[model samples]
Structures are given as C-alpha cells and as structure tokens.
Target: MNLSLFILLSLFGTILSALIAFISAKGQGHRAVMILLALSTGVGALSSALFLLSGQTQLIVLQSAWLFGTPFVFTTLSALFFFLLNTVACLASVYAIKYVEQYAEIYNVRILDALMAIFVFGMQGVLLSGTPFGFLFFWEVMSLSSFFLVMADKEAASVRSALFYLIMTHLGAGAILAGFMILSGESNFESFTRLAVLAQNLPPATLFGVFLLFLFGFGSKAGLVPFHVWLPEAHPQAPSHISALMSGVMLKMALYGFLVMVFGVLPAAGTTASLIVIALGLLSALYGVIYAVLERDVKRVLAFSSIENMGIIFTMVGVAMFTQAQGLSDFSHVAIGAALLFAVAHAFFKSGLFLGAGVMVHAAHSRSLEVMGGIAKRMPAFSGAMLVLALSAAALPPFSAFMAEWVFIQNIVSNLATMQPLVQGVLVLVLAMMALVGGLALFAMVKFFGIGFLAEPRSEHVAHAHAPELTISLPIYLLAACSVAIGLCAPWILKTMHFAELTNTVQWHTDFALTNTTLNPFALFALLLVVFGLVFIARRASSNIQNERSYHTWDCGQPITSGMEYTATAFSAPIRFFSHMITRTKKQVIATPVLATNKWIASRTFSLGLRQIWYDGLYVPIQNTCLWISTQVRKIQNGVIQFYIALIFIALVVTLTIAL
Candidate 1:
C-alpha cells in the first residue's frame, strides 16, 4: 500500500472505531469497539514507522490543491513526528484498556472512546499537514480535541483549567496565523515547499518578525517560560494516560513546528536572532526549575520540569544556530544533535515519570506530595520506575539525559571559547546558569521521588500502596527500558539519528574521546549491582541483620512524628527562600501568641501558594484590556430589535461613506 494512503486510512480507521464505540454504548458492543480502537492505533503506528524507514514516502496528494497549491507532503520531518505521535498514541491506547475503564462509570464510555480516537487523529493531522494553512487548520483541530479531552472531567477545576488552556492556545493560534500570513505575503507561492524556495526573496527584517511571532506561538504551546501558565493546570486536569501523551509527545509537535518553520525554511542563521533565542531559553530554564523546586503538587512539578527541559533544548538550538551562522558548522552540528537527543530522551523518561506519578496519584487519590511518602516498600515496581525516571531527569551519569546535557554543555563551552568576546562572555554566563538549573532540577526530582516515596508514608492511604494494572505498568516499563538503552548506546543511536541530514549539511561526527567522558547506562547499572552484592555479602558474613533494632526517625533526641519529617514544603524551602525575590512566593499564616517569647509554641497554621511570573506580568494585563473592550461592546447589544436595526443602518451608512 502507498504509505500516505495507509497512514490516512489508519486515521480513518480511528474515526470508524470511534463511531462504532459510540453506537455500541453497552456491554459486549463497547468491548468490541475498545478492542478495535487499540487495533487501529497499533496498525497506524506500525504504518507510520514503516513510512519513516522507507525512502519512497514523498508528498502524495490525497486531494486537489489546498489553499493555492499547498498540497500535503510526506517529508522525513513530518513522518518522524507522525511516527512519534502514533507510537505513543498506540501505547496509550493499550494503557487505556485498564485506565479508561476505571472512569467508565463516571463518564460515558462512548464519549471517551470517540474523543480518544479523534484526539489521535487530530495529532496525526497536525504532524502530517503539508501547508501553512493546512497546518494551522489542523493545529486548531488538535487543540480543540485536546480541550474537550481536558474538559471531559467537567469538575470545577477541570472546567476552569480547560478554559484557561483553550483561551491561551487560541491566543497563540492567532499569533501563529498572523505569522503564517506574513510569511505567505513574502511568497508568491503558498505551499510549504514553495514557501521555502520563496523565502529567499523575503527581507531579513520581515523574516525576523515572522520568526519572533512563531517563537511566541510555538513556544507558548511548548510551555516555554513567560508563556507557560496553563501547563501545570492542564496536565493535572487530564486523565493520566492523556497526561502521558501530552507531556511525552504533544509538546514535541510544537517543537517540530518551530524547527520546520524557522530553522528549516529560513536557511539563514543570524547573530541577534540567535542571542534572543538563547536569552529567552536561559530565562525559561531558570524560571521553570525554580518553580518546579517550589511545587508540592507532584504532577505540577513534572509539568514545570517539562518547561525546564524544553528551555534547555531551545538554548542548545540557539547556540547551534549562532555557531552555524558564524561558520562553525562542526560545533553547530554537535549542539543541534545534542538538543534533538535531549528531546528524544525527554520524551521517554518524562512520559515514564508522568505515568509513575499517575500511578502514585491513582493509588493515593491525591496530588499533594506532602500526603504521599514511603511507597517504596509497598509499591516497589512503581517506585523503581520513578527512581530511574528521577535519575534521568536529574541528568545523572549513565542516563540518556546526562549524555544529552553533556553534549549540549560541551557545544556551548566550545562555542563560547571560539566566539567574539562579548558573545563568548554572555554564552559562558548562560552555560553557567544552565549548570545551576541542572543542579536545582536534581534537587527537585529527589524531593519528588524521595520525600514523596522514599520516607515513611505520610498519610494513611499512601501507607497501603496499590498497584495499577499491567496495562498501565507495561508502557512505563517499556519506556524506562528505552531510556536506559538509549543512554547506553547513544553513540550507535547518534549514527542512526542522521543529525546533519536534517539540515542538508555535511555530517560531523563526535570524537570517541569525548564520548568516553560519559559512562553508559549498562556500565553504571552493572557497577551499582556489584556494589549492592558486596554490601549484601558483607551483611551476611557479619550476621548483623538479626541484631539490628528498628527505631523511630531521630528527631534531635525527641520522638519523631509525621509532622517532624521533611514535608514536601520543607524540602523545597531553600529554593522558595532563594527564588522568592524573583518568582515571588506567597504565604498565608494564622498565629495566636499568648506572650512574646521566641521559644513559645504558639497556635499557628500556614499554607503556601505560587503564581507564575508571566501570569502577573503579561497575560493578566492583556486579559483586563480584553475584558474592558468586551464590556464596552456588550453595552452596544441592548435587548431591542430597533437598536439592532439602528446598528445595521449605521453600518450601512458607514459602508456607503467608505465606498463613496
């Protein structure tokens, strides 16, 4: 079968399954449709992978010219994204067997089934779109589907979060449309391919304007800092499986868009533009980690961490572009390769981590980390996965994240050493700050996995950890395994990555000596096992296990209580204290003091709340202005047919005046 047709048919299959699911609303029928949904996604994913590997896939016209000869093209880039989307969507479907069924009682099974299929279909369309007009159209469709998915819960917070996500994304869509129109104006032709050829005629200033517009539009969707207000709310609002897809795969689609539009089409790398992107990236990385560190909600912490990782990738891309423009293509290759690797690694580990978080939330029935502690004993499999994911997120040695971060930093350091004095200094500072961000990320992850799962259970429910079904656990296990494999075999993976080919440039290989600086996961895991074996042998030889006495946590010679343990809030206290001046933390407390003694135990209670810098700084002001304008407009629409007639007459007069 033709690859494009097969892919489209796969999507059609999803729609078919959805329709079937809707028709079969009860018992045996619903079961059959659910099976069909999984089968469709599986076949679709397989087809996408096949197309990605095949060289025959090209721009195949499924219909006539779309918006002026802009027909769909099956490029390697678009195919790669489809490969990712379908693969994850397939896995999520397998997972949904158990995950979605749990909520079947509360939600209409038909609605979940159809929306799930439509959501996958929409994402595929977004990735496969061949023209700017088509892409934007599919982008909105994808957002609309996801918005409905988010709103599926229909709880108060879910509704609010869904609305916030919908509004923010729509605003981003407007910017994106404007940018595409600007790009279209520069082109006599309208197709993506034609636009690329026509882009050469565009003035540099106009190109830069379009670039900035895209940066805001795509960056907002990718949850870059200063534009990441909706992510925390939206992720928590969705089902765990959907959260996995969103955090794992959906955001990458936005990144793919930015790369295809800006770097892929523009074909020029300018210094000022690179610096702006780099500066924005650095700020985002810093801001994201700071907020993640202070977050007590487990899912929100992971969500903010996604922003941080995206920031890191963006910074690497910026550095690469700067170097490439400066004629240091070797350094540029390394930088860009590292950024892509990071994205791939992040997709695996972050999704695994999110799934682990979902399992914890499901078992504990809460999002607060303070209420969840020491599930390691009860939920070993879930905790084990969480630990590995946490280690990867922290960029520890032998994880894929470590390899990516190392390469990224090396590229940054190499570029800084070779660049002009001012650029070098600024880049050096950015790299230093990035290193700090990595450290803070480690701190945050430790708090998330350790304080949340390592210590004694803080709440009664958490004390008895429940394991989710194998369907949910299997995907997490598979991704976790991939994370380890990719880290260990990064050199081999790099060869297959075809990094230089993406830019249509000469391939630059990494030096084996440099690659040797990082230890592979196989070696790290082996070393750990050996160390653990030696400890076990030593303890066995000493026969000291029987003599060991169980004791409460040492609390300065006093009895240890749950409150005395390091709560999530207390664990993040240092970051909150340091970042308060910038990120701005809010605390609410009520205290009653009988006397002014410093040692006195006063009756007191406290709570913590956080707000994003962008919310207070940008979005609110714009929202207020929009509200004011709407209010003024609302005054014009009084409940009167005569008033409407008068308005129509005024409009006719205005039209006549303009025509005259």
Candidate 2:
C-alpha cells in the first residue's frame, strides 16, 4: 500500500523470478521470468508515483547497525527516483524479450535473466536507500552487478570496455564513500535525518570539499565531463536495453544522489559552491556538444550529447543554488524546478531515442548512419518514433526538452538582472554556452535523421534489411508518446512538480502561470500537422503535374558504390574539420588501385577513423608506463617456490624489526 512496501515487493519479485528463471533454465523460462520482472517493475512505478504524489511524509525508517551507521529514511525525492527506476526497468524488461535473443544463443538465458533481475533490484536499493551508508552499499551492489553485465560479452573490446567501466565506477564509488564519511564526521551522527544538523554545524571549507567529492563521484556516474570517459565505451558495448537503462535511468540515479546530498542534506551550501558548479557545468556543456557534433559512431554521438544535457541540468542547478544563496528563493525554485523537470523530460525522450536507434541498428546490421537510409519508409513505426525523439532531443518548440530548456534559460536571464557584476559575467558565459550547445544539438539530430532515416538507402545491406520486431518498436513509441504528452501539457505537469520544496525555496509560487503570451503546445502541434499536410498535398499535386521519374542518385552516370555515398564519417567531416583543434580527428587514407596489365583500372578507396582524446592523451601513456613497471615487477614473480618462501620470510623479518 505504501511506497516503501511497493519498492520492497518489486525487488522481492525480481529475486523470486530470478530464482525461478534459474531453476527452469531450459525452454521458455527466461521469457516467463522476464514477464514477471516486468510486471513487478510496472507495479513499482505505479505505486511510487502514488506515494510521491500523495504528498504525505511517508517515512519508512528502520534502525540497523549493519554498517558503521544507523540506516533509515524515505521521502518524496527517493520515491520520485524509484518511480523513474522502475519505469525504465519495466520498459527495458519488455525490450529484452527480443533484444537478448542475440545473447541467448551464446549464454544461458536463465542465468542472464537472473542477473537482469538482480541488476534491477540493486538499482532499486540504490534509489530507495535512506541513509548515505545504505545508499553506498546499494551503489556498490548496482555497480558490481552492472560490471558483470558489461563483461557478459567477453570479446576483447567488451573486456576492455567493461574493465574501464568497472575501474572508473569503483573509483567514483570510493570518492562517494569518502564524501559520505566526511559528511558523517561533520554530523557526528549516523542517521540521514541528522544531516541537516551537520549542515548547520560544518564550516564552509568542509562543505565545499564534500560537494566536490560528491560531484566527482556522482558526476562520473552521470557521465559529466572529465569524468565521462567510461560512458562512450560502456554504453556502446552493453546490450541495447541495458544501454537504454544506463543512459536513461542509471545516470539519473547519480544525479538524484547529487541533488539529495547537496540540496536535501546540505542546507548551508552557498554562493561560492554554486558558482563553482555552474562554471564546471558550462565547460561540460560546451565540450560535450563539440565532440558529439563530430562523432560518427551513432551511439557515441548520443552518449556525448547526454553529457551535454547533463551539463545543462547542472548549470540550471548551479543557477538555482546561486539564486537561493542571493536570497531570491522564488527565482531559485523556478530554476531548480525547471532543471528537475528537464531531467525527467530528458529521461523520457533519450531512452526512447536510444532504444529506437537500437532497433534501427538491429534491423540494418550496422551502427553507421551512412549505411542507413529510406528506413522511415521501411520501418514506419521505428522511424516515426525516432523522428519524434530526435525532435524532442533537439529541444524543438512544444517538446518537453524544449519546455525544460526554455524554463532554464528564462531563469538564467531573469537572474542576470539582479546578480552581482562578477556573477553576471559568468551567467553570460553560461547562457551563451547553452545557446551554442542547443544549436550544435540541432545539427547533430538533423544529421541523425537525414542520414539514417529519410534519404535513399546508401548501402546494399540497408536497402535489403527489414524492419525491427514489433516488440522493439512498441516500447519506443510509448516513450515518445509520453514526450509529446508532457510537452503539450507542461504547465499542468509543473503544478505537480513542486521545485520550491525541493530547493527549500518556500517563497517561490508553486502556481507557475505564464503571462504576456499564451503558451499552448497543442496549438503548436496542430499547426505543424497542418503545415506538413499542405506540403504533402503540394508534393502530390506536383507529382501529377510534373515529370515524376526516379533515377540513380545524380551519380554523373558513373557506376555507384557504397563509397560514393555520403558516409556518416564524411557527413560529420565538416564539423570534425572545424573542431579539429578540439575533436582532434585523425585521418588515414589508403589508396591502392586495382590494376590491369600495369594500367590503373579502378580508383582506390579512402577510409576514415576518428581519434580518441583519451587514448592518445591518457590511456596510451598509462598503458606504456604500466607495461614498463610490469617488466620491473616481473623479477619478483620468479618461478621458484623456495625463493618465494625466503622472500616472504625476509619481509616478515623486516616487519618484525620495524615493529621492534
């Protein structure tokens, strides 16, 4: 009946289904287990929404000495995050029905199903945990389980990506653990409820340190810049539904953690900390977008764009914090509330878009956008879903993403009027960066749609590939529908999202009514429909009036080849070239022409590969250093048992002498 009970039941259901799935390791056991798991998640989402919207202080507390602290507490925020978690889990569960068929051929379906259940449960624990300690325990559980999931493929690249993800996430967890410990020290208390007291007692420096720690820890998870290296590798390597969950919900879990820890717990965080956050956010937004615009790997492009969005959300939060510190609680609430709404909107559209991309990839047998075209005609459902998703992602008018971005930018502009001169200068940069990222995002989305869906097929494989299964397309459609609904009815939805309470900005009015102009998203949608209808009619009329003939795609009467078509790499080439100073694209061309009797008969080909900043910048040097270090350390692991015993005895003697 209560939210806590609902969450526990959902987790329990996963565990039960996992066991059943394991027991019935043959036949249709995986499907059955997945169905039950999906049902539990659906129930969890529904109940969580009920709990959060109920607006009652439904505290589910229990004192436990399992760790160094007492753990217990659940409020509206935890409920909100759990709702998101379960919703995504349910969608992903259904998707796995067909998505995991590729894996089932290699691994036991039952084992994978069991792991999937455990993975969802671990995420629930992370979201539902009341105390920092409880949160950490579940965080590790989530990370470890996810690590195993990433390594499920065990291909060389899979192994590498999984290893990178594991190391980075655990490193992030360590920082989070340290942050919690520091906050715990300041509190001199073990309970999350007592965090407010610690916030009041701790000095500014300690608060700032804790903030940075949490930033690195959770920012890594959220795939914020500098800490975002693991995401591009991890997301692309994981299975599709897993990628959807990771990008959509798991990243948001970290974001929820950051917000809960900072805004919920640290009541004393002020201007300086907020400014630092905003500055970092601006950099992330700029950097993420620039790289995203240049990426040819479709999933990687999406992944980088996520960094851009997260940066925008963080910037909004920073503005909210800054405004709150300046005693403008009304503006602060408006800003932070808008950011939270954006987070939700982003989750809906991004998940749907990624899943849609997954469907396309499966159908086309390629992740390269260059190879795909005319898919909108081939797979209408998937293409339409992707179109809506891409539009939303571009922050087009009336879409939920647009509404959120508008609210955020409006809040920033409003604050510029009253901010200090120095703060005003930074606000300019933030607003400008947001604008720039939005434009780049538009370009990127256009590229995705134009190259991958609308034009004629660029390759034989894509021309011949069929539509994705209904199972894949259906979930994406549902999510895209939610995006449209939310966009069309934003004001009504914002009424329920009480941002004022979250930021402790009680002075802000919860009734966010717009003045000066009517903002009707429904009107915008209708207008778009009409405009498109007229265009379609005109095109139809022209086809009847004019010569309507199809021919080879203006190839100058030369025989066409896949290379002659616009490749994804070539499409992004202009941006890549422009941003070469930043993106550092490395190009290699191998031109070996086919020859007949010592005369060149055919022109050679050109191949392109993008440079990884991390590889040349960090990984290669670290790898080489480690190799060199290993060579030195190899002397110690000599194949002699007697020598090893002697070395251990010598170390023991050294320890004894040191103790003496």
Candidate 3:
C-alpha cells in the first residue's frame, strides 16, 4: 500500500468519526457513536503503526501549491511520534465510551465526541505535516479543540482554566510563527525540507535567535517550569479521558515541534542551545515532583507528575543535543532512543493512571485524596489496575518506565567517562537530580495509592464507592497489560522499531546490548514473577494451616476513628516542612467561643494553602502592569467627535513627518 494513501485513509476515518459524533449529539445513540469512534481511531492507529514499522523513509506529498505544500515526511522520528499519537487516541476513545456517560447530563455529549475526534485529527496532522503553514494550522486546531474540551464542564473554574490555556497556547503559537517567518524570508519556502537547506547558510546569531524562539514556544506547550501554570489547572478541570489524552499524547506534540525545529531546521544551534534546555529540564524535574508530593487532589498529583515526566523527556533530548554537538553520535543516538522509548512508555502508564483516577473520582464523587480510603476493597479491578500504573510511574522494574529510565541513566553514565572534568561534574549533578526526582516520584505515588486506596474510609462517599462497569475497566486492563508487555519485551520492541536503524554511528552486538552492558528485561521480569508466586503460595499455605479470625483494629486506649488514619496532608507534612521556602506553605488556625460565661473555645478550624511561586511572583506583576496600562489608555477615550478628529489630525501629521 502507498504511504500517502494509507495516511489519507487514516485521516478520512478520523474526520468521518467526528462527523458521525456531531450528528449523533441530537440523538440517543451516543454509546454507539462512541464505539464507532473507537473503531475509527483503532483503524488509524493500526495504519500508523504499519507505516512506521514498514521502514519506509520516502516523503509523500499529499498536496502541493506555489505558496505552501502539504507533505508527509516519514522519518524514523516522525513515525515514532505518529505511532504514539494514534495509539493513545485509540485507547482514550475506547475509555471515553463509558467514561463520558457521567458527563452526558452536564455537557453536550455530541460536542464532546466530536471535539475528541477533531483533537486526534489535529494531533495527527501536526505529526504528519512537512510544512510550517500546515503545522501551525493543525497546531491551532489541536489547541482550540483541547480548550473547548477543557471547558466542557461549563463551570466558572473550568472557564478560567480554559482561558488560561487559550492565552498561553496562543502566545506559544505566536512565538513559533515569528521564528518560522524570520526563517522563510522573501523566498517564502514553507516546506521544512527547504527550511533545512536554507538553515545551513544562516548566520550563527540568527540560528541562536531561532533556537530561543522555538525553546520558549515549544517549552510552554510542553509544560516546562515557569510557563507550566496552565497544565496543572487545565488537566484537572478537563474531563478525565480528555485529561488522559492531553497529558499522554498532546504534550508530545510540542516535543515533535522541538525535534523538527532544533534537529531538522537549525542544527547549528545545538551546542549552545542544549545547555539552556538541560537547565530548564532539571528545574522542571525537581520543581514538578516537589509539588506532586504536596498535592492532595488525585488528578492534580497526576498533572504534576506529567510535568516531571516531561522534564525527564526534555533532559533526554538535551543529552542527545549535547552529545551530538560534542561529536559523539553513538551516545547521542542512545539518548534520543531513550527519550523515544520513555515517551511511548509514559503514554501507556499515564493514560491508564488517569483513567484509574476517573474510576476513583466517579465512584467517590470527589477528586480529593483526603476523602478517599479503602477503595481497593470496593473496586478491586480498578484498584489493581491503578496499582500497576502507580508502580510503573514510580519507575519500578518490569514496567515500561523503568526500562526507559535505566537506558537514560546508562547513556549518561557512558558519556561521563569521555567528557572533560567540568562537563563530567555537570553530568553528575544531573544524575543526582534524576535520582532525586525518582525518589520523590515514588513517595508521591505511594501517598496517592496508600491514602486513596488503603485503610478505613475517610468519608461517607468513599465508603459507598463501587467498581466501574466493564466498558471502563477493559481499557485500564489493556493499558496495564501493554505497560508490562512493553517492558518485558523491550529489546525486541526496540528492534522492531528499527531503533538501531535510526542512527548509523555505531553497531550493536545484540538488540539489548549497548556497547558492553547488556539488559535482559525478560529475565529480570521472570525472576520477579517467580518470587511473587512463591510469596503468594507461602501466604496461602500459612492461612490454610491457621484458623481464620476477624476483629476490629486495636486502638491505644479509646475507640478508633477514621481521622486516626494517615491523611494526605500528614503524609506530605515532612516534605512541606523541609521545602517551606520553595513551596510557600501557609497554615492558619482559628478558635470559636461557644459559651459567653466562660469564654471557652467550642471548635477550631485549621487551614493550609500552597502558593504557586511563579504565578505569584511573575505573572501577577505582569498582569497588574497590564491592567494599569489599560486603565491609562481608557482615559484617552472621549465621547466628543471633535476631540477624536483633532487627535487623528495630530497623529496623521506626525506620521507624515516621519515618512518624509
């Protein structure tokens, strides 16, 4: 099959799915439409996977014109991302079939379905596009579609979040456009191929400027720190399945743009620009995980964790850029491969985690971890799936994330030996940061799972929680299975991805061996499985030998209460204590008098608040300045037509004098 025809078929399927969803909005066939949408997305996913794995590297021009061309470039990099977008889209659609039912009463079901299809379509377009015009067009489509989805709840909070997302995303798009126009010049060559050829002749200063523009532009969308305020706000406000897609796949679109601009368009800026990227990535990794540890909202914790993972990905990209600049092409490829592998791994586990969060939220009627406990007993299937995803997020072995992170660490360790002492010292610091991020990630996930799924119920809502239907559970199960399978078979999967073929600087003795080090994930996974089996059998035998007994948990000297159980806040209290300077935590306690005669206190209330340092320190000042400037400008608005005419005449005279 021709690659262009294959891509066109996938596009058609997505568009048709959107049309069907739009028409089905006014009818009672929403479930049926969603299933159809899932099937359509499945077809698209299959097609993309086939195209990517087929080892085809030809550029397929779907349409061409004088000003711009619509071409699909099938590089190893683009193909990998295309596969990521389509795979996540398919699974998210399936998950939403039942997940969106709860929102049907609160939102327009048809609009939700239609927007989802359009979002996937726009993401695919961004990955497949070979021209700046097409890229920006699809980029806006993706952003707008997601914005509407974030606003699906029609609440004041969702509206505010949507507006923030809209403003930040467009700001990024504007920066990207400015960089592209500067590069296009009078020739107006819109194609990336042409831009790449022209980039070689650009001066160093111009290339560096373009690099800065792209870093800020793409970094905003990628949820890099400082520009990342919208992410935690928007992801939690959006519907859960949409949250899954946004965090799982949509964030990678910005990565796609970075890869195109930095590696494809302006390779000359690699050495200088990479240091800045590494710094930003380190900050994001540490800052994001710190917040995740303190977050009490289940979805908000996942949102912050997404930022941490994005930081890890950006770090891998920086490693790639830095090694390539230093003329170590093999090490560069290893870093790039690690980034790609981690991306695929993240999409699977993170989507599953978000869907599991949806299950918890729907069952408990709250996103607050403080309100949930002992949910594993009520929703075993969902909790089990959540446990798998949580372990993967913690970078445990026999999970996809562990494999990726191991490869990343291996790349860093391999390169440290050959670099200068200063560079080696910097790498050591990066390694420590990565380790710190991992430890904090584990701490956060344990809090999430333990507080939300274990011990006594914290609230009446959680006590009545139940498992979701098969429709929702099925997707979570599939994603969990994929995470484990991908990790266990990573060597073969990497080989099938033509991972080695993506670079030519070095040759490997085997699929899993990088230079001297060999990774047998399957062997490690099997050993863990055997150990788990032995423990399970031993527990079962011990239980059979002894008589079963049940009793209430012992309290020290009084009756036990749910309050005695560890709360999410208490779990993170130590972290807050140590990091108070950065987290800016505030606590308040107020006592009320019950009896006027004795002036005795009846009850006390304790409150805790966490401030966003960037939002408070940076955006607030800018926002206030803008408001003041707007107020001053309003003073010039007068009702009198004569005053306006006089002002215009003076402005015209000034313009004429400057022109002369």
Candidate 4:
C-alpha cells in the first residue's frame, strides 16, 4: 500500500471516530463509540508500523496545504513517533471503556470520547507537520483538548489545575513562536527544510539565543524542573486515561519538538548548549525522584515519577548532543537510541501504572496511599500487573527500562576515555547522579506498591476493595506484557529502529544473547524462569510429604489494630528528614485540653506539609513582580480619555524616533 494513502485513511478514521463519539454522547451508544475510537487508533498504529517497516525514509509532502498554506511531512522519524502515539492511544481508549463508566452520570461522556479522539489526531498532526505554523496550530489543538480533559471533573481544584496547565502551555508556545520567527527572518521560509539551511548562516550569538528560547519553550512542556510546577498539580486532576496519555505521550511531544529544533534546525549548536542541556537534565532527575520518594498521594507520586523519567530521557539526549558536537557519530547513535528506547518503554509501563492507580483509587474511594492497604488478596490481577509496571519503572533487570539505562550507561562510560579531564570529570558526576536517581526511583516504587497494595487495609474503604472489570484490566495486562516483550527482544528492536542509518554507525548485533551488550535480558529471564520452576517443584514435593498447616500470628498477648500498620508517610519519613532542605517539610503538633478546669491533654493532632523550592523561591517572586507592575499600571487607568490619548501619543512618538 502507498504510504500516503495509508496515512490518509488513518487520519479519516480518527476524524470519523471523533464525529461518531460526539453524536452518541447523549445516548446509550457511548461504549460503542469508545470501541470504535480504539479500533481507529489500532488501525493508525498498524499503518505507522507498516510505513516504518517499508523503509520509507523520504519525506512525503501532503499535496493539500494545511493552515497558513503549509504542508505536512511524513518521514521515517515521524512515522516512529506516530506509531508510539497511536499505540498508547489505542490502550488508553480500551481502558477508558470501563473506567469512564463511573463518570458517565457525573460528566459528559460524549465530550470525553470526542476529546480523546481529537487529542490523538492533534498529536499525529504535530508529528507530520512540515512547518512551524502547522505544528503550532496542532499544538494548540492538543493542548486545549487536554486542558478540557483535565477540567472534566469540574471541581474547584480541577478547574484551578486546568488554568495552571493552560498558562504554562501558552508560555511555552509563545517562546517557540518567537524562536521560529527569528529563524524565518526576512525570507520567512515556512518549510523546515528551508529553515534548516537558513539557520546554518545565523551568527553564533543569534543561534545561542534561539537555542535558549526553544529550550525554555519545549522544556516547560517537557516538565523540566523550575517550569514543572504545573505537572504535579495538573496530571492528578485529569481523568486517569487522560493522565496516562499526558504522562505517556503528551510529554514526548515536547521531546519531539526539542529533537527537531536541536538536531534538525540548529545542528550547529555547539558544546556550550549541550552542557547546559546535560546540567538541567541532571538536576531535574535528582529533584523529581527525591520528591517522588517523599510524596504520599498515589497519583502525585506517579506524576513526579514521570518527571524523573523525562529527566533520564533528556540526560541521554544531552549525551547524544555532546557526542554529535564532538563528531563522535557512533557514540551519538547509541545515546540517542537509548533515549528513544527508554521513551517507548516508559510509555508502556507508565500508562499501565496510571491505569492501575485508577483502579486502586476507585476501589479505595481515595487517591491517598495512607487510606489503602491489603488489596492484593482481593485484586490479584491488578496487583500482579502493577508489580510488573513498578519494577519496570524502577529499572530492574528483565525489563525494557533496565536495558535502555544499561545502554545509556555503557555509552557514557565508553566515551569518557576520549574526552578532556574536565569533561571526563563532568561525565563521572553525571554517571553518579544517574545511579543515585535509579536507587531513589526503586525506593519510590517500593513505597508506591508496598503501601498501596500489600499490608492490612488502613481504612474501611480498602477493607472491602474489589477488583476492576476485565475491560480495564485487559489494557494494563497488555501494557505490562509489552514492557517485558520489549526487553527480551531488545537487539532486534534496536536493529529495526535504524539507528545505524541515523548516526552513521554499523548495524547492531542480531543475536538473542545480545552478544555485544553488557547484559542479556533474554538470558536472565530464562534463568529466572528455571530458578522459579525448581523452587516450585521443591515446594510441591515437600508439601506432598507433609500436610500444610495455616495459623494466625500471635500478637504478643495484645490485639493489633490497622492503626499500627506503617502508613505511606511513615514509610518515607527518613528520606523526608534527610532531604528536608529541598523538600521544605514542616510539621505541626497541637494539644487539646480534656476539660475547661484541667490542662490535661485529650488528644494530639499531627500533620506534615511539603513545599516546592522552585515555586516559592523563583516563580512566586516573578508572579508577585508581575502583580505589582500591573497594580502600578492600574493606577493610570483613571477613566480619562485625555490621559489615554497622551500616553498613546507619547508611545507613537517614541516608536517613530526609534524607527528613524
């Protein structure tokens, strides 16, 4: 089949699905619409995979012009991202079938289904867009659709979260616009191909300025540290399926923008830019994981974990940028490949984790880990799937995340010998930071899984928790399976990605043993399977010889209560104490009198609070300054026409003088 024809059909399918969903919103056909949306997404994914496998590297320009008379370009890179976007969309849609049923009465189910379809469409448009104008148009569509999705609950908090997200998104978009306008300049070339040539002739200072603009622009959307305040607030407010998409693929769209700007447009951006990227990525990774470990809210923990994973991805991207600047194409290939691999792995596992969180939240009637416990016995399937996802997020062996990180570490260490002493020292620090981030990630996941699912129920809600329906559980299971499959098939997946062509490196080894890498997940997985089999056989044999007995544990002559169980807050207490400076943790204790005549304490109340250093120290000051300036400007608005005219005349005169 023709590549363009396949893309066109997929696009039509998505649009048709959205239309049908809108039409069916007020009726009993919501489920059917959702199923159709999933089917459409699956078709898109298949088309994208076929395009990539066909080795269609040449850009296919859409004959029909989009907004601003700009065409869309479908290249191998775009096809790869399209595959990822559609694959996740398909899973989210499937999960939403049962998940949204709970909200069917409270919210507009039709709007939710329609927005999901449109969101996927907008993402596809962004990837395929050939010009800045077209990309920005679709970018706004994607952002707005998600904003409404975040505000779907219509609670005061969700509304506030949506507004926060809206502001940050536009700020990022404005930066991108400014950078693109600067690139276009007098010629005003709309096509990226033309802009690439124009960008090469720009002065060093001008190029660096453009790079900074794109960094802040794309970085904000990517949830890089100072600009990341909106993420934790916004993600948890959205419906769980939407949250999965936002964390899984929406952030990756920002990453797609970054890659295009840095590699495609400003290939000449040198070591200084690369160093800055590396530094920011390192800081975000460390900061994110530390907060994840300290967080008590279930969705908030997952939100922060997304930030940490983004940091790891950006760190690998920085390594690729550095290698490319130094003309080390081989190392650059491996670094960028690792980033893409991690991205795909993260999409699968993180989406699964968020879906599982939704089920837990529904079962426990809350999003707090403090309220949840001992759900594994009731929700065995969910517990097992969530465990797989948590381990993957923790970057343990026999998972795709571990393989990607392993590849990243290998490249960083291998390239150190060829660098200057100062560069080598920086690389060593980066390596150490990566190790620390991985350890903290494991700690956070353990807190997430162990607190939310393992022990006795901490509240009445959790005590009677039930498993989610098959419709919801199916998607989680599929995603978990993908995470494992990707790891075991790492070598073939790497080869098929065509990193060799992109970085001018040799074809990767095609052995199931992963012969050229430090560790082989396939071999490790087989070994683990054999070990489990042996242990199971031994246990069975022992059981046959002697009858098994079950007994309740003695509580040391005292009755135990759920209150004695370790809460999520208590689990993370030590980490919070050590990182108090960064976390800005505060505690309060209040004592109440038992009687008016006596000073005897009746009860004590304790509470803990965590603060964002960036929000308080950086953004708050900027916000206050803006408010102060606005207040001063308001003083001039005295409802006088003469005063407004005089101000306008003075502004025109100043503009004329500057123009002359």
- Predicted structure with the largest lDDT when compared to the true one: 4
Q: How should the candidates be ordered by lDDT, best one leading?
A: 4, 3, 1, 2
- lDDT string, candidate 3, 506-530, tens digits: 3322333332356688888889889
- Candidate 2 per-residue C-alpha lDDT over 1-660 given as tens digits, one digit per residue, 9 for 90 to 100: 556566667777977877887789473687788789999999888977877677664466444665565344556666777777888788888888887785576556766777778878778877667667678877887887778777666678877898999988998999988877777774544556567566667787888888888889998898877788888888877777877888888888888888878877776467888887887787778777877777767788788888888888888888878877877677777777677778888888888878877777776777777677778878776788888899999999879899887776766665578778866887787778888889989988988888788767776777776776677677888899888987887877677644324435343355443221266778888999999999999988777645566665677778666555566667777787778776775667565657766645666666566676765788679879989999999988889999999999999999999999
Q: What tens-digit string does per-residue lDDT give for candidate 4 at 215-316? A: 999999999987899999999999999999999999999998898888778755588898888888988899999999999889999999999999999988
Candidate 1 positional error at 176, Å: 1.7
Residue-wise C-alpha lDDT for candidate 1, range 1-660, written one tens digit per residue: 676677767777878977877677453355566567667777767876676555443556365654455465666566666666776677777777777777776556677677777777777777766677778777887888888888777889989999999987998888888877776685443566566666677889988888888888988899887778899889878887788788888898888888877666675768888888888888888888888888888899999899899999898888877877778777777887787778888888888888778788877779999888878888788678778888989998778898888777765654465578766786777779888999999998989888888777788888776777898888888778777877888776665433324444444454522364564556777898899999999989988778889877667877665676798888888877777787677679988776777637677889778967688879889989999999999998889999999999999999999999
lDDT of 2: 0.77
Better of 2 and 4 by TM-score: 4
lDDT of 4: 0.85
Q: Given candidate 3, what's the lDDT at residue 225?
A: 92
lDDT comparison, 1 vs 4, better candidate = 4
Which lDDT value does model 2 have at 357? 74
Candidate 1 regions exceeding 4 Å error are 1-9, 26-35, 47-72, 186-189, 414-416, 499-525, 542-560, 587-606, 638-646, 657-660
> Model 2 segments beyond 4 Å from truth?
1-4, 61-73, 186-189, 499-509, 513-517, 534-564, 587-607, 618-660
- A best-first ranking of the candidates according to their TM-score comes to 4, 3, 1, 2
Instruction: Judge candidate 2 at residue 67 and give its lDDT.
Output: 56
**Model 1 lDDT, residue 57, Cα:** 35
